[model samples]
Target: MKIAPDVVRAFTPTGKLRASINTGNPILAAADATHGARGVSVDLARGFAQRLGVELELLVFDTAIKSVEAVTQEQADIGFFAIDPKRGEGIHFTAAYVLIEGCYAVRNDSPIQANEQVDRPGTRVVVGKGSAYDLFLTRELKQATILRAPSSQAVVEMFLDQGAEVAAGVKQQLEADVLPLGNLRLLPGRFMVIQQAMGCPRSRGAEAAAALASYVEEMKRSGFVAEALQRHGITGAAVAPAA
Candidate 1:
């Protein structure tokens, strides 16, 4: 894994690897009182910086779209994102290094008990604004009215606030949100599985993107990705298969 000098420059034009971290997705990153941000994304950023032979500067964001914007605008060198075609326009994504499930949750009194029941004419689904689920359900769900919250962490709360029929997001997130409230329950299965990957600005050149893709593959193959997930106490997310 010898990194070329030009490839290093592509990731560290400012002599520091600026990794855009989004805390909106708790599975990827979260704000910690002891530290500014911590999660699997932070560990991966640190690992990438170590390999690039540069200092690491984490640019914290509260939403996926914001994080994507930082990389796409070239303000940051790399970012963690759920791969989506709309975002592929400005960024080059590696094969997913992590896979997380997306599911629906609803009030116990609600009649919805299965994934298929969520797309009916009267059902209103609340999802995070500009998230993978937001983009996904927008395209996949034809009848359900889509409502957006400020962030993924806020989706369930927003759903409750609006008295929406359903809440949609990461399964872990939905579980964490509905656990304390006795009234909400998750649907039988997931609506989608998110392919979370590292990405760089497309302007960084194919060589740079390829180098990143290779780095992620190595991380997966060497068990670094799996170990990180365990270390973070993150469950319901699986390390993706090698390229």
Candidate 2:
């Protein structure tokens, strides 16, 4: 996709593409062994810079909230985020490029054997603050109490520490985090599907947003998204369908 000059200027005003990459979403992004951000989100951001013919400056953060804040606060030009109504207030989102499973997990002996059983009046569900799962559950769960963790990476520990009856987050993250401990198990199936997309601050105008959205669609149609997931060895996430 050829990025228009006006859209290019809007996205890269400082002659460099400033991208806010969230390392907390392990399904789409994570810190490498060397601590640099890696995975599909990083690859897409770098690819976007190449398409725009600009230098790429990465502003890495540990959570989606921080990443969204970077763009909305004008500290960065663009960010990768899960497209949600709450986050859409200040950001213009592209069509979703990936779909991640969001599920509930419980202790092995907990009574919450299914996804539908998680929303009891007294059931406490722990989620990463400012994450897609957190936002979705906050809206969908009317009865259950949601305990917020500092970040998605800490949700598992927080669930155990706070004695939350259920933990909600990316299914891949919950499984990996629980692998070392034998007492927890993921509820069968997912409660929600997170739609991961690229976004720019709404102040950047429709042209910039449209440009980025087109790029996302092209990437999906060309199988770039699917290839990126495989190349990164990312599992449990699927490429989103065409909009």
Model 1, 1-243: lDDT tens per residue?
A: 999999998888899999999998878988876767999899999999999999999999999989999999999999999999999999999999999999999888888889998899989999999999999999999999999999888998899889899999999888988999988888887999999999999999999999999999999999999998999899889999988
The segments of candidate 1 whose C-alpha lies over 4 angstroms from its true place after superposition are none
Pick the TM-score winner. Answer: 1
Task: List per-prediction Cα lDDT, in the order shown.
Answer: 0.93, 0.90
Error (Å) of candidate 2 at residue 20 is 0.5
Q: What is candidate 1's local distance difference test score?
A: 0.93
Clash count, candidate 1: 0
Give per-residue CA lDDT, model 2, range 156-212, as digits (tens): 999999888998888888988987899888898899989999999999999999999
